[model samples]
Target chain A: MIPTIPQPRLLTAAYTAYVVTFFVFLALPLVVVAVFAFNDSQFPSLPWEGFTWGWFFGEERPVIGVFHERPILRAIGTSAFVAVCVSILSVGVGLSNAFLFNRYRFPGQGILYVFMLLPLVIPGIVLGISILVFSSRIANGAWDIAEWDIEALRPGLTLVILGQFSFIATISTLVIAARLQKFDRSLEEAALNLGASRLTAVRTVTLPYLAPAMIGAFVVAFLMSFENFNTTLMLVGSDAPLTIAMFDRLKEGSTPLLNAVSLLLMLGSSLLALVMIAFQRRG
Target chain B: MKAEARIGLILLLTPLLLWLSLLIVIPHIDMFLVSLRERVGVGEYRISPANYLTFLTEPLYLRTFARTAIMAMLATLITLLIAFPVSYYIAKMARGRTRSALFLLCLVPFWVSELVRTFGWMILLRETGLISTLLQWAGLADQPVEMLYNDAAIMVGLVYTSMLFMVVPLVTTLESLPDEVIEAGYDLGGTNVSVMREIVIPHATPGIVSGCIVVFMLSLGNYLTPTMLGGKDSLWFTELIYSQFIVRFNWELGAAFGFLLLLLSSLIVWGMLRLTGHTLERTMG
Candidate 1:
């Protein structure tokens, strides 16, 4: 665009080549996954056999694909449920914390804020293990107090949600708090001046102002919980998300069925991106 | 800070404070103590530093830790190298819808799960993968070649996984530089190398520091990427930490290793910030 700015011809050629190579590096692997999904070979790897839709549509007895796989479907269902619960819990907690920090301050609020965001700073693996240890200690103490014989306490779905929420809620709080920083309080004040209760003012004025951010935060929590593997893997006993399930399949060696799963995941995420982009354009 | 607001603050903050303390603060404290203990008998433990000592004494653990740290740093460096040009293009050259589209390109891949992304690499690079198939078709090879499970594979996975973290920050900082600065440098007879060294790199310091810090931490703490791409032979430190907890059920040793990782990563990131003459507040952004 700036003709006189003068990029040398050699440098220009090099830059163009670099750009193309980088794009190929970023994109080609993902494309390969989709292309190989339809290969008739049982393995996801190679030797291009003729295309078949069996990977996407097959019978239960055949066990050739993900379709009609109850275990995987149940895992999907569990993940959705956990993600929903995490979204609601995180948004509620995050909103309340954001309100506290933004509107009202108490002693040690600074320390409290740091502690809340620690989950984001610390490794997810560490967070998962810490929660597991803490819960087990509490459960063990309680069980001992009751003097009742029981199985040693181990992590469950509840602990998984708690582990994820330990950090994700903090992320929600940070996002909402950033939104809150710019939000004017005069609308709430005006409502209060007009003889409305504080609760009424918040419900009528503040909540509406915060609704978009709340939705954004909820989506963040849901996605993070849904895709979270490191933390959830430690806490999940018999249950698994798509990530954990996929990891299991990978460890035992993979097949084209898993490739079908990868294809579906790719399609699902692309759809999510398009929808978000469309939503942003509308806004 | 007002007495009249105390009741409201208490009411709003109690649940949050209780939850954080119970979940985060207490667990970290528990981990600290657990990391210091020795299991002497069944259902009995005492304060000892054997776990930490073991990490120091074991050559396998020590070598893995050193390798993991070196590889993480190397990955961070490569990511920075790859990201700088692309970030510069998006921030300075591209405009309007084109710029937005390019920026979106870097982001869209991240939304897919990391597991899926790593699987994508395996599909292309494994012995019977796309690459091998292509080579065989071209008569370059007699059979499929194994491309996965090596140092190069791990590096590829690491760089691919963390490149976005590097680019986004670099773009953010570079976009703020006025075009006139570069124009001024050129008018003063600055060549490309001189201009890049004296102006562009200096201008991009905060972004560079932040991006490197982030990429390093993410790569160092990663468990899934290395295990998936590097196969069984990969001795990533996180896998060591993971094996302690999940495989051996050794919480004491795992907690020690976990703390060591946290300590090492934080120390390295902080030292980097100091070396680059950036404050924690500025670089953490």
Candidate 2:
């Protein structure tokens, strides 16, 4: 076994070229979006006009920034609110489910585990329709009181959060469950042996270890809910998320304003990802 | 203590189970029932396979379904091929910081919405697109060539979007392989092709299977990329489902189509798992 052999020039060149080309392919589209966001031209593509901040900050007719736009701002607000609610709901359910699966050996656990993954397995469009119709007919009717107006029972932000949570929580469960798998049960046992109550033992020892994962899951779930379109599209009524708003505008015809929104979103996601990696590394 | 733990477990499991049964399981059962019935009279229906039969008999529905399946499969293969080298470079070839940076580079683009990503392609491949402009500048064409509203553009969009899903698994699996093993093959006078065939492929089969499965499912169920990039004429199967449910208000037919999609992808994935002898747990991630 020789430690070294000179690689053929052609093979090395081919491999290098292959890697570089793939990187460009992976990058060029998003880069195109960001670059075109600043183009003074109204078109999202083509011969570059001189740059302007019209899409972002200009107050004139076409230059009105997304920040100042009303519908777009409302859509952003709706998206953020729904995403936050979904994240919190998902993390709560997921942590409980994760605890149930990871800690105990229960009958039918296998069946429940498989059932949990069905949300991920089913198509988003199908899930959207399911939630939409189910809420409108069956679930809504069941929860509807004759004389009471329950704002939470409708197919708006509440339904959106519920729909997203059904699957996102399962994903969150998987993440937290993975973290839990590495835990030494004896730590909890040791706390118990030290005369701490069972609740206190879990609250102190196991919960601390699970905190990092729960936080990670929260961020991941929030981002997932924000980006989700197919399920959200059908489930949403009388209110639009950023994706639906952008989609409606795209159908009408796109402007650099959409690109500006995309640029901001891309930066936000990049920062979140960096923060996540840093947080995980530090933990 | 045991009784307490049992009560706690039941309490913990109740909400998720109730949630799934209400929102997921029952809805699907209802969808299944919807798929089984056709409108006999106003508000009247019977259990029959009329919807499924329509899917099988109608050439338009059948052709669209077949085409979407074939196209999605092709996109998965293309994504796998393109992502392999990038994953290998990051996992096997590159050193510490360079590897992380390259991995991050692969990831950062996906943070944008899928719609936005597809829109980027729209901007790039339109008649007056950057590529068309570049071609004219390089004297490769006389005028801006119309690149949009075509299958190739759709393929490009699908492949580009699915890159991350494919790369992550491949990199995860490849990362665990000791360099000494590859070096050993080289020392044994194994040529590149033989070594890769005997060593790399076998070791990477799980990652490859998982990646392919995920990409295939995602692309098949995807409604955005094909419609956006391929324009009105794409006739993607998901679009047909959309029209059935939303446009035509034919939930029975749409339910059938939706269930068929789920069944088809599941069957293909199941068959692949059996063929490759991979487990659901291992391939899922």
Candidate 3:
């Protein structure tokens, strides 16, 4: 079949060139990152002093591979922990939110819907700092009033989860809600008509329909949490997430180790992203 | 509503309220309050506009804020201009597997952290980096040219970071436009430019607006791209906010800067929506 909006020959050639350039721009940095990960050098940039997997598996001094690096490994663990926590919390809250928006009508629903979207528009740094400031105030106020030492209220993994959940829940809600809207209400109705309780009907009928979207949202939430920087940066305590950890190391200087970790991150996230796309297609 | 239904409604509303008030609403209000207060001394505070006043009066802060706003706008505009054709090529020109592959390619780079992306740019643009090395090898320059730590480098990084965001929205919008409409335009004896300007752009307005808004917000609030690529002298407004909060231990000043950024971003996004004759809801959809 002919393509839509057929162009003149010169225009077609120009568009082809433009598309090629765009993809090259997109792929170049990632290729460079992956390539230098194996470089047998201290620096990430290259005159390509031959290839080796030293950055990924080395044990020599100053050539510590990512697996051999304690702090980097700890940072990755911290990031995974935070992502898991954020994903579970976001999806749980998102389910309630989708149910609220789709299954019920309430006063000020329109305004509340708009407010739900505010987090999406607000800058991540803004959300992070605001949460940081507000929680610190509460923590300090508790100390002044009751001598309560709620250390969890301070900047830490807890705050990171909360800050990430603030926006990511919105995304999950949108995803699940999109799926929920397309659901045939009559299936639940039929289950209810067959002497099933409301909860039973929902559990058996509705939840099954939403399974793919929920899984998709979970993967997406995990990816966003793991890759988040600005928000995580503000909320991090001593237990820094991967992004913060990488950022601190970057400020110090670039290392092939950083490239190695990045290559790993790229691989991990791409797999998760592919899972999300597959679920989206299936759903 | 019945009592049980009312209870269920309240149950659903609980999470939404807690999320909005405890997380989004109250924190923002606290931020505003903190912005208006200045710490006079230890365990002492005074309500004042002095923090904001400092921002306006300080030449460095004011200049950085202006530079950041201008740069973010330019980045947004550039992202739109660049993404439009690529998105069009994917949504209209490419078929089946090619379309999906192009779309997936757009997403692959973003899977990594922004730090990694910045690191990649650093490797490409740094003094001892590949491009400079290439230049020297080609005898195009006598020195290893420093490509990093400048506004242009910062712009490149910003544009790169935002391209995927713009492309996603534009592609979504463009995909929904029927091919028949464009064919009809051609049948009406319209040139490519005329059809594009009159038909294609009008159809993609929502996408363009949403993409611009997201890109502008991202570029404005971006921290890592500017700092990593443009170095310490980047003078990006977000970095100022960051320094005030983290380095200077001056939360009051940082809070003020944060509010100013929030306000400015809101105002700009609102203005864009109004100019484009779209609402946040409509464009977002």
Candidate 4:
């Protein structure tokens, strides 16, 4: 109800304080990560040593404080590569699935849609284990069928990408499907009536309309793939994704270099998001 | 359909179908199969009900499941309690740029990974961390307060991660409420609290239900927050499952635990749908 008086000043103040504190709680860790990235100390703790950019651009230490390492860079590259592959595959598969489901109603459409969401509902660890078992079985069965020695199929970047795509595609499909719901079918009809082929009509009308959502879907998919841990952890081979690498480091014994990596990733993602937003606005 | 359209549909449906069949359907079937099997060794699979028996017979496993459910419920409730007023404020009172800015602030955390966010909480709640230091500095305690690596930490992590889900839907639903209904309540001499209870709350019920369901499912299925924050002795159901399959190489027990979690979440989702009178497909999608 619109009270005769505006929100009581005391109430507003209290609420404001609560919200401010909540945001502080939310933001503090990120701030700590950023701040400690420059600390000269090797550990992620308070009483920062001096502000130094050595972690980002520094010489290596032989024994312990080797902040600038090639492995970290290689892990980052692997993560990017995997994320890119997952993004493209998921987007492609998701967009097509969305198109198929939206444009045509099949006999088992409802069942199919539910099946698409099954990956989302399942526990990540279970999904990972199942995939691992299934892949191993396939590799074994193939070896038996060929009656020849075959290298054991191990979990690696390829399997990780596949594992990620299993669910990321589902998310992308949902996003694109939501966008497709409001799409005006008459535009396609009009294009078709104007002597354009169905494919041409879709290319001109449907694709343009779904472009923004598809882009958003791609970004979400990429982020999910890149930051994924549970499934990646289970499926990761000798070479690890950045998230797994960070997790392993944390579990063993973490250093401020972990904080440095976190800050770098945060900055990279934020910049990417900003660029996408700017591009969308400009377009 | 045209030949090209037929071809396109085939191309689109094939990979998704293959993915679902291989990754989802087959694995679930495998899980079910494994659930009925006997555990032999670290990574051996066989057919038996020994693992299921372990879960069914053991008080520890049952207690873990019960504890997980109770913890998830508490976290969902806490998240709702914390998120509702803030959502209402943003939806009803905040204006223009302030509203947008606050909303954006709510989403800013989404830029970071959930793992990182949980790690952030771990940092703050650790015995020697900020919270303990602050409490000591404020003279509330002689020694640093011990907070981390417990059920409370697990709840905090869950709530922190799921807060946005509760807030966003609540804000959207509350914002969409007709001003006229609120005005009508006021014209009838209703107080702010009365109007909120009668008008605002009822309108926001769908959102609240959906939000609760989302939070509950997420919390129930959550493995990371509980494992990381709850520490070794937490022994959450998912962690138990992980230990069985990954550590002990007991696939049957792990499968049984996985099925229990799945069944519980599915039942909750189903019950929520029935209670809210919303279709599961619509709500979840």
Candidate 5:
């Protein structure tokens, strides 16, 4: 390392101390969360209860582990289902956005490009509320005018997916577009020059090149959809996602079972994060 | 364009048009329209600005709104101060593996849901939690201290939630600074502080502005962190919006509050970009 000057010993020591403290502060809460997960107690707080797997595996009436908890399990399933739908939809729309922005120039393209970023700048809560208001208005109009009730437009999982897709598509677009910008046009041109049809050239050459980005965007989008709370909270009706369920339980009271669920979430998300990093490195 | 290419362009544009219109443009327009409608009777309504006027007249709402804005700005500043040195250390001082590892450490917490992170803080700062226990054990307090349910607790949670956003951008900007530039500054007899003030801050302005924008917006719109950490006393503006929609079931008022929040945040972000002489494309994109 090149020092601008001989760093004063005091400054260097102080910086070192600060860095250590900063990391400790970052890790402390997460550490406490994980530790209390296994603690053999009713509460998630201190007083070093002996470690037990009851929070995960206990069959007792009071210590109904997260696995055995019906609502929690159902919420997990709901979250997974929503995440899958959001990822697929986001990636599909994202691919279209990438092609639209990258492959052609059109009227209002600059304005459209800025407009595309509107979802990112807007708050998540407002996004959800807007969608909620708009869809329900449509639903009411449909019923009133045409005597046809549109169930999908009501506050439910479908609206949840639509709400998340509003912004996630922007992200997937950014991810895929970054990769698309680096593409060599001649590669597709060469294929076209070799008597291959345009569709064949794109399918054989361009789409394969974009595969890594699509996959990367898929994973990132899935993680985001799974962990989302603010927008999902507004859109969810009966089938609450894991986050909302956990939030409700949190408000009711503290329990080691909540810690157990938190530990599981941490581990699951850590695995996804590692997968994302690996994909980024490889791509 | 030729016929085939024209049709292909139409196909390409269809999804963008539909997605933006159906999900974003139309909905927001509908929200604006809804915000202006006042319910006159059970099933009757009229165009009015009563909802917006209510926001202006309610002292509690006004006070809460101001408090949220001030707290969010304070949190953003705190996040910047804490992240700068750590980012510098990771970007300039730390070696290869250590740098990546430290950066990864910063990112890992964010990978989990914000609920989990806030839950962790709740466990630590609640009256009967670890910090209070430690204080008692250390003879620092005679009774358990209620660290949660206060503005300071909310600030702590907000900063923790947004620290990675600040660090990632700062590190990206700092890493691009050539070492020779720093060496040159030293060669010209510049001290560390002066070199940092002139060279580093200028180079990092785009990153700083972008990071601040994101952090400020996040802190302002945050519901889970403030609600969970600060409890009923949080007085966060987002809570007002949430209750109007969820608890009170007043869609018109909620829509107005949502728009006000949108307007305020957009104004602040626009002002920051202008003050820093950075475009949103350059800073955010």
Candidate 6:
């Protein structure tokens, strides 16, 4: 409903307050982490003990404290590796699924689509547990039958990537499918009529149109995979992802170094997003 | 029709089919089998319905499911309430660069991880945190308020996380409404409140329902928010499921709980579609 006489000033003031408050809520923890990253204190809580760059690039041999932890770095690297793999796998799978579903009409298509979406509806914890138990059982049963040692079935990087890909691919499919729905089918038809093969038509016309959406889907999937904790925590064997590492640290006790790690992650993601946004603008 | 097209379809579907089979279908089949089995000592399985029967008969597990359902409903309702006005403001009142900027601001929270975002609320609600400090400074409380690690904090975290999901869809629908229709209401001597109640609300029903469905499903499935914000003793249904499988090594009971959650969410999604007069496919699309 449109009011005849608009309360412009009041509306603007209220909106400004809301926006400011939202940003405050969003930025407060980040600001805390960024500030605490430079804190020389052992604790994550306040009562600062001056400023130091020890956390960021500290160089003492076998450095003690939270700054020089090997596991934390390893976890971060593992998370990055897993995220990349999941992103590539999800995007590839999602794109093909999108193309098939969008272009074709087939029997039980509705049922197939529902099956695809099952992962999104199911709880991550349940998925993780089921995958872990199922994989272990299969590995053990196979080994007992063959009378051979098979150690590769343990949950680790592979399981983490697979678990994340289960749902993240669904997200990618939905994003790309939505974009595809708006695509000009006539463009592809025209390309085909103008002597292009179906593959050539898709490559020359449809693929370019879907590029931005695919990229967006990739970024979103990658971020989701990277930040995923529930599935990763359940399925992680010996090597922890970054989120699990942080959770372990928090369980032990909160330290400024944890905050420092959070700060680094925040900075890393924000920079990546900024670059993507800039590229989008240029394109 | 074409051989190449047929082959393309097969190639496209093969990976997805294999993925779903391995990761989803196979695991679910295994879960169903395990659900029929009983835990015999540490890390052993035996065929029995003992765990399922226990979940059904036990008051604690039953109560946990009920409470989780109630909490999820409350969270969905609260998110809808808060998101409606904000979505309306953006979709109706704001325009030009201001609207785009405001929309971007709404999405900025998505950039932060859910774990990190929940952590933000934890810091705010803590004894020595900003909220407590503010209340103390304002003389509204003699001491810092004890608002953290409760059902209320859990609701806050859930609502905050699911809010954007509600807002985005609402904005899409509300933005689609023609300004002329709204102005015509005013021209016909209809009051603003009546116009909204009679016109805008009806038009926005589909979006509201879709948003509510998404938010409800997410809230019902959420585990981390309740665990972190509500603490160890929260007794959320998902947490119960997690405990059963991870801590107790009881897959059967966990499967029952998981099935219950899936059933509830599906029913809610069905109800949402029926109420909005839209199919699930349309709403999801």
Top candidate, metric lDDT: 3
Q: What is the DockQ of candidate 3?
A: 0.69
The ten-residue window of minimal lDDT in model 6 chain B covers B115-124
Clashing pairs in 6: none
lDDT of 3 by residue, A1-283 (tens): 1265555788778779989999999988889999999999889876788988889999988888998999999999999999999999989999999999998887899898889889988999999999999999999999999999999999898999999999999999998998999999999999989999888999999998999999999998999999898898888898998888888888898889999999999999988887787887887
Residues A1-283 of candidate 2 have per-residue lDDT tens digits of 1124467778778887989988887678788989998999878887789898888886778677877788988998999999999899888888888888887788888877878876766778778777666665554456555555556555577888888887898899898889998999999999999999989998999989988888889889988999998888766778999998999999898889999999988888777777777767765
True contacts kept of each: 0.53, 0.49, 0.70, 0.37, 0.69, 0.38
- How much lDDT does each candidate structure score? 0.83, 0.84, 0.91, 0.80, 0.90, 0.80
The stretch of ten residues in a row with the least summed lDDT in candidate 4 chain A is: A59-68
Local accuracy of candidate 6 as per-residue lDDT tens digits, A107-181: 888988988877876767778877887888888888889966566667788888889999899999998898889
* Clash pairs, model 4 backbone: B36-B48, B37-B48
For model 2, how does the per-residue alpha-carbon lDDT over B1-285 read when each residue is reduced to its tens digit?
788988998899898788789879988777788889889999789999999999999999999999999999999999998888778878887888988889888887777789879988888889988999999999999988989988999999899888899999999998888888988898888997887889887998999998998899889988888878886667898888888887898989988988888888889888889999987766763
Runs in model 5 lying further than 4 Å from the true structure: A1-5
Clashes (candidate 3): 0
Candidate 4 on A1-283: residue-level lDDT in tens? Answer: 3433366788778877887887886688778767777778766665557887777777766213224587888888899999999989888888888888888766888989888877766667667777766776677778779965434355788789888888888998998888888898999999999999978998999999888878887887888888887778777888888888777777775567777788877887787677666655653
How far does residue B95 in candidate 4 sit from its true spot (Å)? Answer: 1.8
- Which scores higher on DockQ, 1 or 6? 1
Model 6: per-residue Cα lDDT at residue B229: 84
List the candidates' TM-scores in order.
0.94, 0.96, 0.98, 0.92, 0.98, 0.91
lDDT of 4 at A155: 76
Quote the chain B TM-score of every prediction. Answer: 0.94, 0.97, 0.97, 0.92, 0.97, 0.93
Clashing pairs in 2: A1-B187
Classified by CAPRI criteria, candidate 1 counts as medium
Show the colliding residue pairs in model 1: none
- Model 4, stretches more than 4 Å misplaced? A1-5, A62-67, A147-153, A279-283, B1-8, B39-46
